[model samples]
Target: MRKTVRVAAIQAEPKWLRLSEGVEQVVELIGAAAASGARLVAFPETFLPGYPWWRWVDSNQWNVEYSTRCRENSMTRDGLEMRRITGAARDHGVHVVLGFGERQDRRIYMAQAVIDENGEIVSVRRKAGLNPIERKVFASGTPNLPAVRHGVIGRVGALSGQENQRPLLTRALRADEEQIHIAAWPGNPEGEAAGPDSAATVSRMYALEANAYVVAPCAVVGAAAWDRRGPQTGRGSGQARIYAAGGAEVVTPLAAGAEGILYADLEIGSAASDRREVELAARPRMRRGQQQAARTATPRRLGADRWAVPLMLGSGPGGLAAC
Candidate 1:
């Protein structure tokens, strides 16, 4: 049997201060994707209402309490609207991964909720860290976050905003054999100005290093979108791409920064085949052995011990320069 699944990435505008409107938009988008025969769909970061870039636009200029109220109003996890969205996913038999504002214990968080085909929430991840403007509105995630398997499809992990650029975090998560990696970009109105290259490269590198597939669904931002809307929103340019195993981009929906659904068919077996080939490679195994040998042969040194030799040797003409 062919191991295949159709996935979709949606890029669209979300109405601020109107979460009901946003959820309805998401349901509409998910319905469209299900009609296109997608089994899974993912949305951009903070898709509920909108991303909170306005927190940076001088909150002092506005009523401080009201700005806080606005953020608090947008944060939600379980409600009638959430149940409706999840029910739609269940009814359509489409697994949904969506970013939303999460309100928990008097704290607002940048969170993504993964709902399985049964309309059940499999995992909820709070953004591990906060960005510049985010610090004003949201809190941080705990340390236990990494890729977690939702159901039978694959292991899923989330990277919000610049967290995509953190190499160590990616490696740690990818090391565990994550099959589907989701990078949720906080969209701005400045087009690709907010590290679009880094966004693409992060997904590509994760796919290659993890020997798995990466689904990068970004927020759409553009000059006109910003000017017409307001400077409070940086941009709304969406770019959703899929990188196959071994760093090959299998399919990319052509419309960049536009509001639409980008679809791709994923083959999980391809990732396994790629990793088995690399694991069987002589160079890779030899590199591992070399690392082990170096670790064993190297002397155990503390701070002063490590510098002593270099410092003593540097004092002489033939000595090596201290690190």
Candidate 2:
């Protein structure tokens, strides 16, 4: 039987620094997408309280007030905001992959939550690495979280912001049989002009590497958000896009500064046929004697702490605890 799924990439601005308002906006968007026949909807990175654009626009000390308010507005895994989002997903009968700032105690991480159609929280993944400016506000995450989960359409996974640029991490998700990958990115007014580090380039590369449908949900920084940052700051041009299993463009890139949902119907089962052409995971393995020899060799310390080892090793689905 042929399997097809309609997916949506949400490119909208959050109600800057207002958690309640942001959640309401997202809920309305989810309902709209569901009404339009979207089975899965992916939101932009840190759509809850919005991305830390101030971190880039000003110095750390200058952005302290914005940073503090952002943390105060950040949502916990099972917090009220999350409950509302999941509730919307359930009411609309649509799976949601939402990116938000996840707060634990006093620390916050760039995180994404995968919600099934029935309102169950299937998986929660944190960004394994943060960009330089992002490091000022978010903490690093471990690699042992369940990056992919079985959903109504197929296996879905997500990577936040710059994490889409991590080859090894994307490879691991591919090995876990991810059929659809969500590449959540913050707004970049430069768009494709931002060169190799641009979100557009990285997202397209991930689709080509994983041989899976890639849904790029990007945030838009509007005038209000710029006003909050400081005087005379500019807005971001949205760069939302969707790619098929064979790395073909499924939808034209959302225009810069546009705020709406981009939808596309994907052949979810076609990834199997694509994989057969170039199976990276099934190609070959090291000789048994060489593997044993390598195992016996002294392990090189990855970082100054024990947790760093696992972070560098990048474990598979079995290593993660049930969410």
TM-scores of all candidate predictions against the true structure? 0.78, 0.85
Q: 180, model 2: CA deviation in Å?
A: 0.8
Tens digit of lDDT per residue, candidate 2, span 1-323?
45879999998878988999999999999999999999999999989889877776656566887889989999999988899999999999999999899999989988888899999998887776677888888887765434678766988888887778765567668768788999988786443465787887788888887888899999887667755445443444657989886677998877777788999999877665657666656654555554445455443444432121122112332232211
Listed per candidate, the RMSD to the true structure in angstroms reads 7.5, 5.6
Query: Candidate 2 regions off by >4 Å?
Result: 59-61, 189-194, 228-236, 277-301, 304-323
> How much lDDT does candidate 2 score?
0.79
lDDT of 1 by residue, 214-317 (tens): 77777665443322434644343557778886778878555655677778888764566556666667332234444444344433343321211122121233
| Regions more than 4 Å wrong, model 1 | 63-66, 194-197, 222-229, 232-236, 280-323
Q: Rate the local accuracy (lDDT) of all candidates.
A: 0.68, 0.79
TM-score for candidate 2, residues paired by index: 0.85
lDDT of 1 at 103: 75
Count residue pairs with overlapping backbones in model 2. 2
Once model 1 is optimally superposed onto the true structure by TM-score, how far is the C-alpha of residue 203 displaced, in angstroms?
Answer: 2.1
